[model samples]
Target: MSFKTKEKEAVGVPISESWEIDFQDDFDTFNTENWQDQRIWVNNETHCYVPDNKYGTREVSDGTLKLKVINTGAQKPCDNFDKNGVQHPDTQYVAGRITTKNKHEFIKGKWTARLRLSSNGEPSMFPAWWLLGAENNESPVQEANENVCWPLTGSGEIDIFEHHGDHQKNHYTTGAIKSLGECDKGDWWSLRKGFDVSLNEYHEYSVEWENSDLVYRVDAKEVYRNVGQGDQYPEKMFAILNFAKITDAPMKGEWVMEVAWVKHEFRK
Candidate 1:
């Protein structure tokens, strides 16, 4: 629970000189104006996202935002049914998810967050910080015809940080989902890296997007870069922060992902 102050720097470019802050949240308080609590459940995930603060789905305190996954001990039929009309049991576990859809959408820029995850590593916990095209047809937070189904168009998806607790400690994954032909057939181009980082420690995760190049970084150090050329993501994208449970493995009482702050900066 110790907080460490680290300098924020961008590789090859000085943050202060090359970038201008566009959006930021320090979690001093939950700003509903900037974020919307997402309640839909997909991805065959084990938890149902709820807006209830009592369930620890979302809470702000001590200058940090905590998105928690809680076990409710009882199962309730899910609102979203599967392809076969079978409803999944969802209430056995409830988690939190929030997005900036339609609130703060931006095109090419730098998106970053400072986070510390619960160290329990239940193998079922999945925490992620990502961005989706504002025009993505999935939720349609914007216009209808403006919808572009996933990786086929727009900014696609940029996963700045993803931690699958099932993996070895200190391992994380980052990547982009791009269209191959159609939205259903997209490529999940990604990279995995391991560090000495512990889940209990705070670390900065970021992605810098310039034209067609993307640079991923951890604490200002470069980890991976994507130089592929196909379609340049020219549309605005919104941010999503969530902690999902993807397994049926018996989980501890509760799991949490604490985020100290999030920021978006555009080139000046």
Candidate 2:
């Protein structure tokens, strides 16, 4: 359980290239300069994404951001809509989802997030720290440039860490989403792979562009590699952290994913 600690402005030691920190947010009171609450629907998820700590979903306390999925015991109106332009119906469950979209975006470099789950894997919980193409034509489209659909036309995907609570307790999936060269199509399982880690303790999950490869890491160890898949994700991408209720399985209590920090760097 190696914690990244409070080195919020840390410029990590690099080998071949001198990496320079370009964007960072330590959750020191939820920096609006680096993030925004993103509400959108996809993946046929069960819960609705909410903003501003509603239902105690996105709380920043003690220098960490807690993304929680709370069962409200009643359905409520939701604003999240899908690509087909269908608004999410009233959902009894709600959770937090935030992104660096429209604020911080970068092309090929490195992305890192220090985080940990509050409990071991449980059915229906889906929490992820990942990157999305800036051109993704989802909800909250802030610009006309965001007209491209996901995993297509350089609107690619990269999962730094994604935990499916239905699986093994200390395991998570990571890697790229291979595009099918078509609209709204991406291969979710081909390039992705799962690995085990200390689920309830802080760890730095990261990815980097190493020439023609996309390297995935747990803390500092290379656990998986998407060989030569770097060419699929040349466009700028934004960071996202969210906790989702994916099924109708009864939630025991509070489900949380605590994030310490998120940052990006480029070779200098």
TM-score of each: 0.86, 0.93
* Model 1 Cα shift for residue 180 (angstroms): 1.5
Candidate 1, 162-234: lDDT as tens digits: 8788876676778776667675566765333344467688989998875667888889898877775313566
Model 1 misplaced regions, further than 4 Å: 1-17, 80-88, 140-142, 189-196, 229-231
Give me the displacement of residue 168 in model 2, in angstroms: 1.3
Taken over the whole model, the C-alpha lDDT of each candidate is 0.77, 0.89
Question: Model 2 over residues 1-268: C-alpha lDDT tens digits?
Answer: 1243223225554343667899888888988888999888888888888877759999999999999999899889988998898988899889999999999999989999999999968999899999989998887789989988877954788999999989889899998989898887788998999988888999999999999999998887999999998887889999899999888889988899999999899987
Q: lDDT winner among the candidates?
A: 2
- Lowest lDDT sum, 10 consecutive residues, model 2, at 1-10
In angstroms, how far off is 250's CA in candidate 2? 0.6
Name the candidate that leads on TM-score.
2
